[model samples]
Target: MVRAGFYLLAIMGFSVSGALGADAVERAVASCWACHGAGAAPKDPTMPIIQGQQAAYLEKQLDAFRSGKREDQIMSSMAESIPARENARAAAMIAALAWPKVAGAATAPAPDSAIACQSCHGADFTGGPGPEGVAPRLAGQFAQYLEARMGAFSRGEIASAATMTAMMKALDADERAKLAKYLSGL
Candidate 1:
């Protein structure tokens, strides 16, 4: 009974009155609830988590996709579909969100290649300083999603980051899988 009340209370905050009174940021944040899942923790393994991604990083990626610098059939079209003016607003909206909980994360071990990764992805893989500023967080990514991306980089299908290409190549397919598996579980 209490849980139901709590849910009702939460929903009420997003009710017509609340929504009608919301500012731009609130509306923008709500726009992502569809494909990215309710709060940006994607249920699909093919989707990347954007709930707590760095604003700059997300903006850069969006730009890359829009400009054809990064080639993802879905993202390229999606990025282009949005007006350039709204890019920063969307990124900021997503970035302001908290990182979702990673169940069983404590039981996950770091892969051998995680140290090399830390230079860019940070010690916690929750992002940190990079030569370019912000690096995307990879702590709880989906293995399949990570694997596909690493493979694309290794094969030169995606060359946005030369460093990532080199790293993926050095890891090889097996090591990449291991790294992805470990990181995703976190």
Candidate 2:
């Protein structure tokens, strides 16, 4: 009730703190920074950098976790704790930040296995439009993290996105690793 009311107040241009005040909402979202990191960068390579992600994508993923459509025990519990109405607010704040970049990241030529990925992930592998939804930028992400995620998709551990699972499963471990290495370096 309070969350919605506050948003309503902000929307009405009666924001208490300032013209763009969101201190209360930011406080509520503080827990997200625990695993995601104090800054836009994730502390762990395995953790996806949520900053600068498309707002629609973030909102969709959050809703999926909250609704159990996506099976992430950690994220599900976290999502549950937030009032349903706050999901949009949280997504908006996170998505508005800058995307993290890896300085001097290794770059490699795209392997044959990565050809199909470009159709969605973009020619630069930064991300692009697709039939399903917006693909995330994988250019500066960690190779180990990408490999692990591909492995999870192949094993159905991450079943929230079916296309990824299918694509990961189509390639053997070596191919996936090669693609991950190539994509991560860019």
Best by TM-score: 1
TM-scores for candidates 1 onward, in order: 0.77, 0.76
Candidate 1 per-residue lDDT over residues 59-107, each given as its tens digit: 8888898998887787786776556667887788778888775444433
- In Å, residue 83's CA in model 2 sits off its true spot by 2.7
lDDT of 2 by residue, 21-69 (tens): 4554566578888887666567677787777777767888889998888
Name the lDDT value of residue 98 in candidate 1: 85
lDDT of each: 0.77, 0.77
Name every residue pair that clashes in candidate 1.
Answer: none
Model 1 TM-score, all chains together: 0.77
Model 1 error, position 111 (Å) = 2.4
Q: Which stretches of candidate 2 lie over 4 Å from their true place?
A: 1-24, 159-162
Considering every candidate listed, which one attains the maximal lDDT? 2
Which 10-residue window in model 1 sums to the lowest lDDT?
17-26
